[model samples]
Target chain A: METTTMIGQLPEVTYAGVIIKAIIILAVISAVAGFGTYVERKVLAFMQRRLGPMHVGPFGLLQIAADGIKLFTKEDIVPQHANRFIFMVAPVITAATAFIALAGVPVFPDFVIPQEVPLLGGIFVPSIASDVNVGILIVIGMMAAGLYGPLLAGMAQANKWGIIGAARTAIQFLSYEVVTGLSILAPIMIVGSLSFVEFNNYQGEHEVWLVFYQPVAFVLFLIAGFAETNRTPFDLLEHEAEIISGYATEYSGMRWGMFFIGEYANMITISVIASMVFLGGYNDLWIFPAALMIVLKIAFFFFLMLWVRASWPHIRPDQLMWLCWKVLMPIGVINMLITGIAVMLVLE
Target chain B: MENFLAQITTIEGFAFYLFSALTIVLFWITVMSKNVLYAMTALASGMVLISGFFFILGADFLGVVQLIVYVGAVMALYSFAMMFFDATRNIKENNTNSAIVFVLGGLSALALVLIFAAPIHNESIQALYPMHEGVGNAQDVGIILFTKYLIPFEVAAVMLLVAMIAGIILAGKKMDNSLTESMDEDVEDEIMKRKDLK
Candidate 1:
């Protein structure tokens, strides 16, 4: 079946190549996620007129390494009343789902390893690990599944704050999921394919970013993405002021670090999706190459998320729910309906 | 073991067996576990594993929908509700009628077997929407859903809408009243305030 499926593809990607690519994605994304925290701290500090982590090493360039060492060396602690098994499993769920979601997202353009690269030479590595036809949906699905990490972590810890965090996690993630799906439906309808590659190619071929056509969707997706990732203005899940770090109150050492990594990874995933789906993906600009273009777009989104985080204040839970169900969801549905009619007219 | 392993040549075959085995084990744990939290977690994971079966069969759209709908939304809601209850404690089950339970279980098992076996033996049973060549699985499913099975699809949508409305009405019947506060005191205060205003 695998062979049959790959018969007509432009390049026949090998299993070995996919495995290698998956490994590369895992290592690179994990490293990038760690680096993201450093960048976020630096950016947030700059915004607040503070010099953050300058004493660590060269303006805190090696702060990631320092943090990594600290996390690794710190004692793993579980609350006395916590469910030990689920507590241990929760962070893995978060980290694993975050990485798995990246499987369907194209981080880079497809390229073949040169013949001189020894054993891995002449291998064709596709942009995505698995470019299943329903790529976007599956990526979204995996991210939605990532809610379990926080939900389970908070519930298992047996702390009041953790339970509150878990409760917030449930409502926040579930509510935004509707907005995310509905908002993205416009672009999916326009492109007529769920594959990120297809969305990229469609924009490239038309010489127009999807954001230009579906600006409302682009904005809605960004807001929902922020909430889904539990960023500021919607970071009620772990709102320190009210709940004392929310679901992560009982987590210590690398378990807590795993949640942090998962969050940063999810941020990157959302940035990548926004870039690919709305901002013309990895397509080459007039002066820039495809690779450089995609990196810049993704970087802008990552910085934008941090910028929003630095600037915005958190919303109340009731307000968040009201904004989602009564505001964003309705707008998304209307936008999708309009886009459907427009597409039908154009096609006809 | 070697022969069984050798029979699984494709990645799909290997994944099928792996997911099926894990799904069964997880579901078994879900059913047998005394703790509500543990049961819920196992059930959620089992749902996720079930999506693997769909993916293995090349039904990518169904796999994703299963993930999004079941594991992502439904199970998360289940866990959310589990928060209100003391989920960590073991649930003690009192089986009052083992004989009736066994008979009902056996009957359901027999019905399930018959339902599955019918497809194998029946020659006249045809798929309503045959898989279209050169079309993606998602597009194929969409075409069938919007065309041949449109009525059934609309009916299902309507059913879901009705269920959602009913759920809202049932859950929101006493939204204005605080469960923690005394209703009689509030009512008496309101009556006194009204009398004073008059």
Candidate 2:
């Protein structure tokens, strides 16, 4: 968070530092995304009273590596009637947007590479890759733009199921985006800044996590975040039972793997956002370092997503839209209104 | 070559030229492509690249809003509408009179250039809300929108609300009909009508 030190502000950030940070984010998040699949399977298996992926390696820890090999080595296929260009590009869009959204998110606290570290020595890497003022908006915008990936993928595949999936992607994503924005609006209103660091610092200053003040917003954001990431219970986009993997019906090999990585990456992004905005971010807590605290908070949210997935049943597409527009969106708007009134009263 | 390369490679200059080139190419594709999906995609990307200009101007809030409203929401809705039609099919343009089109197009272009240039030529143009130095971009935008431009902003919002209501009303016609069933019947009737016309 402190971009400068007592030694007269050492250049703010170097290009090498930024580039190194980008590589770390991409590499670490991608690896974590792959590892997340393994974790999800293991968690779901334990919940269902079955051994999942035991044969791959010790308790299936190595399954992620095995799956990576399979995905990479498998033959890529394009449907005969598919739009080759868009079909090929769609998965990349999903992955790219997901990663780009993370650019605005502060994944870890800023750190300096020691002088002993050869090429990148003595460079200070900021927590956020591009520390824009409109960090929240960029994350939301990028995620919203990610809808094109599934929409195009389904449409370009020329399959009826894929088209239906694409339609669901449009409506589901569009509707949920409003709720996500509105839900976060309360916190933004209270903090009076769009930057994530500002939100974190606001909570630290107040000595209260925003979730305590804006519980409704926290709940609303969690729900909308679930829908945005296309997780279970709201994953009507590719609800395999209904539309046979929806937009991904025609996808195979690494292309499909890219979608999986994107989905998991988005899951992590949403979790990081929730943790930072509501759970005091990487702020130090009793007996825990700042970094550890943030990590634990993110892990808890990730597990919560998996736990809910294992427990809940998928809702109907109609019910999903009804819940979004009728229920969640209204609650979000009301929460924002109340927060606005409270802020006004306090100011007065 | 060294001087040119140095000028071109300054991050800001390089980014400006890159985004401009991409935006132009995308807009060109949007206009010329026969496939509706390609056109829609190009148009959306062009809108996104246009937002880069806002970022270049230090209007980070405005840039993100452009990304969200134009590229994220509006273009997405366009694509959603495309689902109802045969989007992959080539659209035939009736270029029956090229001379009239060229004349009209050139006139409009010239008019737009003049309208844009007029503001620059007149030194009387001043910032209605001169942005304060240390204020964040979002705060600056909010201050301007709520104070200086509140009336116009509200009017624009009302106009959008009206358009949205109208869209819902039009789309909600025959809302009780099952889309798949109706689409089948509609397709059959359409083919028959086309056959009759032919």
* Share of reference contacts found in each model: 0.70, 0.49
Which portions of model 2 show Cα errors greater than 4 Å?
Answer: A1-11, B1-7, B117-128, B164-198
True contacts kept of 2: 0.49
Give the winner by TM-score.
1
Candidate 2 residue pairs in backbone clash: none
- Candidate 1 at residue A294, lDDT? 90
- Worst 10-residue stretch by lDDT in candidate 2 chain A? A1-10
Residues A1-348 of candidate 1 have per-residue lDDT tens digits of: 452233255568789878988999989988998898899999999999998888788988998999999999999998787888998999999999999999989877778899999898999887888878888999899999999999989888888899999999999999999999999999999999988878988998999999999999999999999999999989999999999999899888999999998999899999999999999998889999999999999999999999998998989898999899889999999999999999999999
Candidate 1, DockQ score (0 to 1): 0.66
Write out the backbone clash pairs for model 1.
none
Which digits, one per residue and each the tens of the lDDT, describe model 2 over residues B1-198? Answer: 898689678887788889989999999999889887788888988998998998887788899999999978999999999998665567788787899988999899999989888888787998877767667888888887899799999999999999999988999898788798989999999999999999
Q: Per-residue CA lDDT of candidate 2, range A1-348, in tens?
A: 223222345458767787888999999999999989999999999999998889878887889889999999999999997888888999999999999999999988888888998776888888888888889999999999999999999888889999999999999999999999999999999999898888888887787898999899999999999999999899999988889999999999999999999999999999999999999987778789888999999999999999999999999987998899889988888888889999999999
Q: Candidate 1 — what's its lDDT?
A: 0.90
TM-score of chain B of 1: 0.78
The window of 10 residues in a row where model 1 chain B has the poorest summed lDDT is: B175-184
Task: Note the Cα lDDT for every prediction shown.
Answer: 0.90, 0.90
